[model samples]
Every structure is written in C-alpha cells, then in structure tokens.
Target: GVGAGGDMPNWMTFLISDVPLYLIAMPVAVVLMGKSTVIETRKFNMKPGMFFKLLLMCLPMMWVGSMVGSMLSLALSDGEATNRVADLAMQTNIWNVVFLVILGPIFEEWMFRKQLIDHTRKYGEKTAILLSGLAFGLFHMNLFQFFYAFLLGVMFGYIYMRTSKLRYSTAMHMIINFNGGVLAPWILTRVDLDQLDKVSQAAENGNVAAMEQWASQNATGLAIMLVYFLLYGAVILAGFVLLIRNFRKAEFYIAPEELPRGVRAKTVYGNVGMVTFIVLTVLLTAISLFL
Candidate 1:
C-alpha cells in the first residue's frame, strides 16, 4: 500500500503520512508513554542564545556523522540515498516546510529527546543521553540520516537535561531543519545555473578573466552563496576545535541506582520493547536501500 502510494504527489503523500504522524500519532504516543510509566516528561527553559551555543558545540560531531553517512551511502548504494533526498528537497512546498520546520522538530524532540531522557535519566544522565541518541538515529530508519540524527539527539538531550524546557531544543531543531529544508533549496532555486555552467567551462579553459566577468555579472547571487557557505563552514570548524579542545573535560553523571556500565546500558535498552523497535528499524532501513 505504501509503495502504491508513491505514485501520488509527494505533497499529498507527505500530508497523509508525515502529517498525521507529527500532529496526532506522536502526541498520543508521548501521552501513553507518560501514563504507562512513572517518569515525567522532560521540560526545558533557556535563553535562545544557549541553543546557538549547543549547535556550535555539537557541530563537529554532527559534521563527522553526516560526512561518514554520506560517504557510506555513496560507497554502498552509489548515491541513491542522496538522490532520493535531493528529489524530496525539490518537491518541498509550503506544506512540506510547515511539517519540516515547525511540527517535525516539536514532535520529534518530544519523542526522542524528552520521552527517552525523562524515562532513563534516573539511571544516569550519560546513559540516558547515549540511549536516546541511539534511539533517535535508529528511528530514522535510513542510513543517510541515522548518524547525524543521533549526534543531534545527544546535543538536544543534554540541553533538555540542563534547562528542563522543550522550547530550546525545539527551536534549535527548527533552525537546523529550516536551514536545510528551506534556505538551502530556496538559494539553489535563485542561482543562475546557466551562468554557473559558463563559469565552470571558463575555468576549465584557463580563462580567469572570463570567469571573473561571469562572477561580476552575477555578483549579488554569488555573494549570497558565498556568505551562506562561509557562515555554515565556520560553525562546523569552530565546533571541531571546541570539541577536540574540551574532549577530556566532558561531564558524567552518577545514576541514583548505579549498575555496571554494560548492565546499565542493557537495563535501559535491552528490553523486549526496545529490542523490537531496533529490529523493525533495521529491517526498514535495509528495505529503504533497495526501494
């Protein structure tokens, strides 16, 4: 039925599937989890600047994970995964932006960050963060996204722990999503592809003057593109430096009920329910590659 539905417009399909999952299914799941357990849902409250700081701190891990995922996707599937992502990006309209930018971050943080952290945090902060990150990655059920999602999950989880406010993480998530899903594609659409091709051809022929002229004619667009890439690159670079410099000074938390490290992780994740989710996600990820 899902495969058959692929024949429909991407917007329609997204509305039918992603919309309900975000708007309806996720909140119900969260509520059910809260009722089923004694654990209270995680909440957070922090100034907006803190999220930017978190983004900077997490950028290195996020960059490495995304790079690894991309290379693996290329090597294993010959970039089929990336092509599918690009196709989806090209299909984005207002509806897609709403889901991707607003609803998605809110619901996803509620599930992967809030729910997981709130439940297992009594065990240990480190364990809870790690497990939530793992669950977040696996929940994506796609190789191209799993790694970075996990990294971001850890960052978001930590923020939630600190502030106990969901709004901070939600805002951060929305910022990242908007940059990728809205700004990047919108900028790409504004670019003069024909001019870019000419510039490429000019460079290949060793005509620096022609290349300069082409750039001059499209100065405004080229400047916008340059600023975007530079700002993006600088954040990742700063993150790499900070991550390495502070690697050894990382914090750890002791669980109220201390267990062996392995036992602690097992207690958190090695349950029938979690194991079933892990299995299903792995199966779905494998199926996605072929599809």
Candidate 2:
C-alpha cells in the first residue's frame, strides 16, 4: 500500500503536488525538440580550475538573487510560499532526499538548462540563457524563489554553453541543494530551539538571572549555532567579493550572428510555447503571493 489509509506515498505526493508540470511538459518538450537539437548541445570537457572559477562566479550571483527574492517575499507576501519548505521538511524520507539532492537536480538541469539551451542556442546564446533563466525562475511557481532560480538558470545555461556538459551543472545544483536540504537541516537539529523559547520567556518576565543562567548552561550550543551562521555568511561574503572583482575578466563567447535585441527576444520567448509557460508560472506565482 502507498500509505496507512491507502493514500499516496510522500514522494508520490510531492511529485504530484510539486512537479507534475515537469513530468507532463518534459515529454512535450522532447517531442517538440527533435534528436538533432540534442546533438548540437552535447556536453564538452573543461579544465578543473575553470569549473571552480565558474562556480565561484555564479554562486555569488545566486546568493544575491536569493536575497532579492527574500526581500520581495517580505514586502509582497507574508512569506507563506517560502515557509512551505519547513512543512516539506517535516515529511522528509529517503525518497524526498533522493529527489531533492539527486534526481531532482539531474532532471531539472536536463530539462531547464540542457533542453532549453539546446532548443534556443541556435538563435543566440545570450537569448538562450535569458530565456532559460526566465523559464527556470518561473518554474518555481512562487515569488519567493523566482529571482534566485532565474539567476541560477542563466548561470547554469552559461556553464552548459562553456562546458557543454550536464554533469557540471548537475554537480553544482546537487551541491547547493545538499547544503540547503541536508547540511542545513542537520545543523538545525544541533540547535536547541526549545531552550531559546524558554530564554525568551524568562526575559519577557524580567528574569534576567534566569535568562543568564539558561544562556550559561547552553553556551556550547549557542556558540555552535552562532558559528554555523557566521561561517555561512562569511562564505557568501567572500564569494560575492571575488565575483565582483572578477566580473569584467570573465569570458563571453561571440554568437554566430547577433540578432537585434527585439528580434532575439521574440526568437527565443515570443512563441506559443514560451508565452504559455510564462503565463502559467506567472499565474501560479501570483496565487502563491496573494492567496
């Protein structure tokens, strides 16, 4: 049976509720994209240092995009969409882990980064990257993640264009997801939220001594929690600094024949397929933010 009362398993539930579009749309994307398209975008090899350089460059942009999304979530909504991740975390199982950290990245990279790039790269690389980013961001179906996903979509598309390999993008995606899903959750378990609540209560009651006592007792846990956040912040800061310092030095390849900006935009995204996807995602995002 799928569940105690014959309900679907958590993984199935997640797949159905979260990503049914990917399941349905990918086949249509495939039929729409014939075999020759895949061949033209075949993955290529790159030097080891190049991969790290790209990672360092792109990771900071992703962080900035996420921060922007967070601000937008705070301003435009009650963060209900972003907060849903906590609810999802409660239902964690092997399948969720597999899908989140492994299968999900692979499949998404293939569809959004790989297929989209292949489908549009012939027209213009920059246009392809922009379109891929838009699709990827909108695919998240919420304002809380749209900015970051879109930025990452562009970065992933660029990486694919540079290396021509799905593995590079997939590995980067897995690394980010693992840190967010696995490492972050593990760190949370090490922190004592109940104790913090108690401390808050004591302070509210004007019990400074009790608050101090609780803090002293839980000093080690507090230190660990503080250090964990500090470490993450430091890494993001360093990555941002490095990315900015190297921005102009980063490589850009020339397209075969550059289209006018308007023509390029239309060539990549002004079609039934692109418009339908954009409208669907925009509607869903609006619902998530407003409803």
Candidate 3:
C-alpha cells in the first residue's frame, strides 16, 4: 500500500486492532510486570541533585543520536510524497498539536519502553532488546513505518538499559519523536513535495537530451542541499556534546521491589518469534501493497 488508502495506510484499522488491544493488554501488561520492573537502585544511587547530573550525562548522547537519526530520516526515509502526507494529516480539522506530540510519547513509553522493558528480563537483555524493538515497531501496523520504528525502539531500549532510568529515555524519546518523527516530516512534506516521474518517464521514452539537461541543472542543487544538511547536523552534534559535558553525573536505579514480576520466564519468542515476525512483516508488506 505504498500510496494506497489515500496516501496513508488505513490507520483506522490499526486504531481498531491496536487501541483496544493495547488498552486492554497494556493494563494487563503493566499488572503482569509492574512489580518486577522496579529494580534496586541502591547500588546505583547517588547523592542529591543526581537526577540532574544523569540528565546532563544523557543530553549529549541524546542530542548526537537525534541529529544523526534526523539526518538519516530526512535524507533517506521518503521522497517528496511523505511531505504531502504530512500536509494532509496536519490539515485534519482536529489536528491538535499537543495531542499529536504528547499522547503518542506517553502511551508508547508506558507500553513499549516501560512495560516491555520489565517483562522480557529473563530472556536476557539482547532478547529483550530485539523483542522490544520488534514489538514496538510492529505495533504500528503499517509498512511505511515498521523498519525505522523498530530501530527507534531498539535505541530507546538501550537508553533505558544503559541508564536504567525511565525519565531520560522518556524525555529523549519525546523530543526525538515530536521533532524528527512527527514534526520534521510534517514540515518537509508540505514545502519540498515534488515528483520526478514526468522527467523519468520522458527519459525512459528516449528524451535523453532533456533528461541530461535536467540532471546537470538540478543534480548539483540537490548535492548542495545535502551538504548543507550534513554541516547543520554537525553543529547540532557540537551543541549536544557541550550539554553532555556540563551535565555529566552519577545516577541510580529504582529498587526491584517497586516492580512486580512479569508473567513467565517463558518468552513468546526465541527462534520462533523471529521467524514469525519475518513472516508477518512479509505478509503485512504484501497486504499493504495489494490490499
């Protein structure tokens, strides 16, 4: 469904599948793992003002990742069509900006990062990382998204694991998604939306003379734009590093007793899960393409 169902997949169907399931299942997920997700931070604990220090430690890494990830998403994610979709989505009569930014983060963090993090512990962090990422990405229910989202999930999972603090991951996730995921493409799609199909078609039809001229005039411009984005991303990185340096400090984790034990050590995955995800992803891709 590259451009089917009016340029965005039928999110309504996912709303059906995901919203109810998550609402019902998330509470269950939380209840199941709530007690165990909490860990003993005593070993990691620090003096007062430690949270700020942790944030400081996290800031640069978050910012660096943000810049690089944003650059990748912008440079590579979609062509001009994505911008148009953003415009269309934004133009919705009830496009409440605050909800678009906040609701997604809160729910996703709770379900994907918090709950998933707590539950998959016994399988080992590596398994948890893959499962959590796969779960987070696949939960979105569409193809235009699954790959990047899964990658983002993995990254967020790492943040929680390495830092073992919910706030840092929460904050970073919100900013990244709000800016890069939700907003950047929103703006980009509207202004830069373009189609090169006519030119490509002409070229294919032996209009090489015109095609060569178009490439000569436009390719250099495109190359220049790419260079500008790269430099800008670097500057963003520098600022991020400065913030990190100023903010570095030791931190602690929450005690394990605060969290309840998850369902069973028996994961729904091991080898079976990977194969299942691949199959489902392929099937979804086919459905998206044909349906």
Candidate 4:
C-alpha cells in the first residue's frame, strides 16, 4: 500500500484498517500447510554487538542516499521529467514526503526485509537473502525503477543479514528516504510557491533542456549536493565491508514444508484472494503516481 489518507499518520491508519484485516486472517493456511511463512521476530538470534555496529554504519549511508536522491530529484526531475506529470503529484501534501522517506521504509523493511526476506534467508542463508532482495526489487513495478531499487535492496538486505537485527537496516532505510521524501518537501515548502509553478511550467512544456540549464545556474547548491554524495557513499561502503568481516555463521531456519501440518488452510488464501491482493497492490500503486 501507498499508505493511508488525511492528516492522520499513515501507520495509525493502517493499524486501524489493514493490520486488523491481515492479523485476523493470519494466513493460517500458510502457517498450517507450511509452504512458506513470515518471520517470527521472537525467534531472532542476534550476535552481541552486531546491532550497535550496524546502526553506527547504516546511519551515514542512509543520510548520503537520502541527500543524493533529493538533490537529484530537484535537479533532474525539474520540469521535463515524468512527462509533465508533476501536476498530478502530491506536492502540497507533506505526507508525500513523509511517506516516501519515513513511513515507506519502515513498512517495507518490516514486511519484505524483516518478514519475507528474513524468513527465507534465515533458512537458506545467503542464497535466501539474495532471493529476498531480488523479490523486494522486482516487486516495484516498471523497468526504470527495478535496477535502482534492486541495488538498494541488496545493500539493505546484506546489512540486515549481517546484523540479524531489523532495527539497523530500518534506521538505514529511514535516513536514506528522509532527505528526498521528507526534508526536500520541508525545504520546498519554505521556498516561494512560485518555484513550484516554475517547475510545473518547465515540465508541462517539456523543456528538459531549460530545466538542466536552471540547475546549472544553481550550481552552488548542486555542488554541495555532489560533495555530500561522495562523503556518504564512502562511509556506507566501509560499513558494508565491516558487516561482512564480522559474520558468525549459523544454520538456516527451517522452511515451512519441514514443519508439522496445520489444521488451518495451507495458505491465507486459495487462488482468489492471492490474485485480488496483487491486483489491488498494482492498482493502488498506479493511483499513488496520480496522487
């Protein structure tokens, strides 16, 4: 989901709605039949100091990614990008920024990285981790985003794997998203609304070259951004190396198929609910782009 509506916190909205539905359903059949299952946080076996180290390392990487992405969004996504579709975006809603930067990472990390990925990888180890990252990336529709999301997913996945703690990667993700999704909007709000109009005009007219020229004219801000990128990327790279060097290997968690048969359905759904969820996810995602 693209998150909830109104001035209410998206998480609160989900807690009031989706969480209840999912929890009540329990995917009992899946748990019972044992095809595959979500991660049980209580089962996590973390090594000492891993959580602290991961948090220390990821904080900077997340900052760098966020800053760079925001700068790029402002720089490259000016008027001509997205085919003059900027008007359709939720520029006025600060929640857009919050959701993209904060809420989004938290939920995805909780769902894909912490739940699905964790479940698979805990059982199969690195192979499972890789598959989880792949699934996480591909789950985002369209080719343009696949490559970027995939790479980011791998980085976060590896960190999650190394730490065996959700907190570290979740922090990392939130930081990375905060700049573009949150901070940028905050900054933009302070700027004269005329700039948004200017941006919209440039896009609506398909004047990409003008947008580029405008960015060049504001080279000071852009240069500050470039420096930020280099510094942050460097730190994240080092943290990644450190995580790898510190792994204490353990046996993978057993998959559902190996568990006892259940009285519940093999999955949360037969074929019907499964298709419906996927369809709804895609439809909502498209609708989000419009918002």
Candidate 5:
C-alpha cells in the first residue's frame, strides 16, 4: 500500500504512507507489546570525534555489504537486477532530501535501534544487536539494500547500546543517508554519464577526436567526478584500516537474563512470527531481484 502513491511526489508519497506507519503504527505496536518494552529517552552526549571514528569504521563494512548485495543480486538475476532505492536517490529533490536525510533517519532509528533493541536487549546485547540488524535488513524487503542496511543496523545498534541514547545512532543514520541521498546524488547530477559512455565507446573504437571533443566540453564535470572518486576511495581505505585496528576492541555485555549459548538461536529464531517474517522478506527480496 505504501507504493500506491506512485503518482505523487516522492516526499508526499512518503509522508502520506510511511509517516503514518512510523508515527502511529510503530508506537501502537510497541504499546501492544507492553509498557515494559518501551524505551526511555537518554541524554545525547556523544563526542564529535567519537561519532566520526564510528562512521569511519563503518564505511568499509558498508562498502563490503553493498558489494556483496550487488554481486548476489546480479548473480541471481543474471546481471539484470535493478535497485529501486538507488533510482529514487538519483531522482532526489529538496523535499526528498528532507525525508531521506532527516525524517527517515529519525523514524527508522526510533523503530529499529531504540525500540527493537530496548525490547530485545533483555535476552543479551549481542542477541539484541543481531536481531535488530537482521530485522532492519529484512524491513527493506529488497535484495539491493538488505546487506548494507543490516551491517549499518548492527553498527547503529552497538552505538545505541554503548550510549543508551537515540541521538547518536540517529545522527549517524542521518549522515549516512545524507551522503547517499543528497551528496552523492548531487555529485552525480553534474556529470553527463551518457556523454561519458559515448566517449568511452569512441576511445574503444580508436576515435580519439570524438573522445577529445566530448572531454573538452565536459572536462569540469569529469574533474569533479574524479575528485569525488578519489576522496571516496581514500575514505574507504581509511575505513578498512580503522575496522581492522578496532575489531578486537569491540565488546558485548551479557544481559541479566541472557539465554544459554546453546539455545540462543532457538530462542531468537524458533518462533513462528520471526520465521514467517524472514520467509516473507526473503521471498520479497527474491522477487525483487529476479522479477
């Protein structure tokens, strides 16, 4: 039903469909789960340096997850897979930026990190984080997003656990969304990709004159794209180094009601509801990839 507003602007569609679901349905679901499941707001006090460090460490993970998801989708669909989210990002406007970079993160962090983690952390911090990651991944219901979303969800969940504050995770979410939904798209819009492709084709065919003509006209755009790629590559490399250096420092606390290691899998996934949710999401992801 969320997709039913296809004729409307992206922001309007999201407001009419997703806002109600997040603002109303999510809270109602939490109420139905019982008051004990509610998460109380905590002070937002994470340092800027710490946030940057966390974000840097997460970059490589996000890159890897995205690569894996793309590879799997291409393999499954014989290289014909399409990413709707990416398509929407490419079409982003100011209103879309508001929803994608701000409102989306606020509601999503509230639902996935704050609410879900609070409800499940009683089982164990690790368990809660894993569940939150998996659920967040599946919530996308598309193969293109599941892996990167899952990895980011786990990272955000860890941040929430350490600070017991929504602001840190929410801010992190906002930054990532802004990069993907706003900054990256804006950079891409400056480049004439169709002309670039033609230039490439001309070069491959030994038509140097044609390539030079296109380059002369679009040199600035090419320079901008090249700089973006270089900067992005540097960040990704730094992220990998940070991830490796800090991997061993990661810690998980045992909850007071921690389930036994032997039964933890059963405790988390043996339920009918979770199994059904997983099955449905997997089916949807498969459909999105192949059909």
Candidate 6:
C-alpha cells in the first residue's frame, strides 16, 4: 500500500520506513561500533525559565534558515517549487499529529542526539554538535528542510551535550515539530485560500463590494490567521533579541580524546562514508528543488 502516490496512512508509512530505520538500522550500526559508543544515561532536568530562554534564543536561527531555504528553493525552481513535506504536513489527523508531535521526537532524538553524539563526542563537543546537526539536516534530503533542521539540530545537540539527557532535547524537538507539523498546518487549514485570492483580486480591481463580501464571510478565519501570524512574528522578534543578549554566554568545553585544531577538519571529513553521505544528500536536495 505504501507507494509513490502515498496511498498508505501516515502512521503505517512511518512504521514501515522510520520505525525500521530507528529500531533496526541505527541500533545495528551502534552495536557494530562497539561498547565505546554507548551513551551514559543521565537524569533529565532543565529549569522551566532556562528551557523557555533557550527556545526563544534559537527561534531567530530557525526563522533565518527557513527564509534562506525558501528563497533558495524559489530561485532554483524559478518560483515553481513544490514542498511535498509541507503538503504532507497539511494532511492533519490524529495519527499524523501523534507521529509528528510525539513519536518523531523520541526516535529522532535517540538516534541523532543520543546515539550519534555519544559516539562522536570524543572528537570534541563542538565537533559532535556540528556532526550531529549536519547529519540530521542532510538526512532530511529536502532543500526546504535542510537549513532549519541543521540550525535546530545544533541547538538540540548543545542541549543534549550539556545535560547528557535525551529527555531535554526530545522535549524541545517535540515542541518544534508540534508547532510546524501540527499547529501551523491546522491554522492554515482554517483559512480558504481560493476565496482569499478572489478577495485580493477584487481589492486590486477596486471592487469594494466583492472585497467587503469576503471580509464579512471569512471574518473568523481572518482573525485566526491574523492572531497566528502576530504571535509567530512576536516569537521571532523575541528570539532575535534573546540571541543577541545570550551570544556571549554560550559555552563549549574540551571533549575527551579531542582532535587537534589543525587536523579536526581532516579527521571529520576525510572519510569515505561521510564524503559519500554529503555528496549524495546534496545531490538529492538539489534534485528535490527541481522536482
């Protein structure tokens, strides 16, 4: 049932594809890497205020990355870019919500933040964060998602590095996915785009009657959309301010078995697998923009 046409339900598709990758492939890979890669479990505890501040501080990066990605996609596709991920996100349902808002964060954090970081932290904390973030972004294999995913990945990676707790990063990831994959889509669905387009045309042609008719008919939807955008804009602005205030306070520590500064790049990228992954993902991302 899982085909190119996306005939299968979202949960079923996730089970077939994502479940296997998380449960089987990643575990197998970790086991092959040996006992040294095991992540030490730690209690998850972050002050509510700290969590809120961290979230706000990272929002600007998310906003900027999203803008860049969207602009690049538009340019590459000559303004005809189609985001299949956004299309899927718009198909709001309980199953989709559960997967996107809950299960996704659990599995993804365990894989990318917990597993990948555990194995790579020996190189250096910064290196581990960057590696996990870059890999996470590239793994999406979509031009529209790469930038923001990478930015958020780094934020989550830092949280996990500092706390050594999956729960912290997992919770943050959940909130983000909930916003993008659930709440935003729901808000968008409340508005009728076709009618909005008609209303816009009417306004452009100075058709007062038609424009007023739309305003009256879709008052509730308009209000909902207006509130959503206003709140979103506020969050972005707060995040930008927080980022500027906290930029100097950010910290990184020397990692165990840290690589030398001069050879860190070589140690990380001069590998057969990493090179192959970067090249292939870049190609796929580029191809996705065209598609």
Instruction: Tell me the tens digit of each residue's lDDT in model 6 across 26-59.
Output: 7875685466555354556789899998988777
Q: Assess candidate 2 and give its TM-score to the true structure.
A: 0.85
**lDDT of each prediction vs. the true structure?**
0.73, 0.72, 0.53, 0.52, 0.81, 0.80
* Model 2 alpha-carbon drift over 4 Å, by segment: 1-13, 35-43, 78-82, 90-93, 209-220, 256-258
**TM-score of every prediction relative to native:** 0.82, 0.85, 0.52, 0.47, 0.90, 0.90
- The clash tally of candidate 3 reads 17
Candidate 3 per-residue lDDT over residues 229-258, each given as its tens digit: 676476556646655565344232443332
Would you list the clashing residue pairs of candidate 5?
Answer: none
Error of 1 at 30 (Å): 3.7
List runs of model 4 lying over 4 Å from the truth. 1-34, 37-93, 184-291
Global CA lDDT of candidate 3, please? 0.53
Q: Give model 3 RMSD, 1 decimal.
A: 8.7
Write the number of the candidate with greater lDDT, choosing between 2 and 5: 5
Ranking by lDDT: 5, 6, 1, 2, 3, 4
Tens digit of per-residue lDDT, candidate 1, span 1-291 = 011144577667657656666667567657755743434544445666755666787767777887887788777876665434545655557855776788778878888777767766777788888888888888766777779889988888877777767788788888887877788877766667767788788889998888788768777887888898899899989888877786687566675654676687577668786788789888987777667
**Pairs in clash, predicted candidate 2:** 43-164, 44-164
* Location of the lowest summed lDDT over 10 successive residues in candidate 6: 1-10
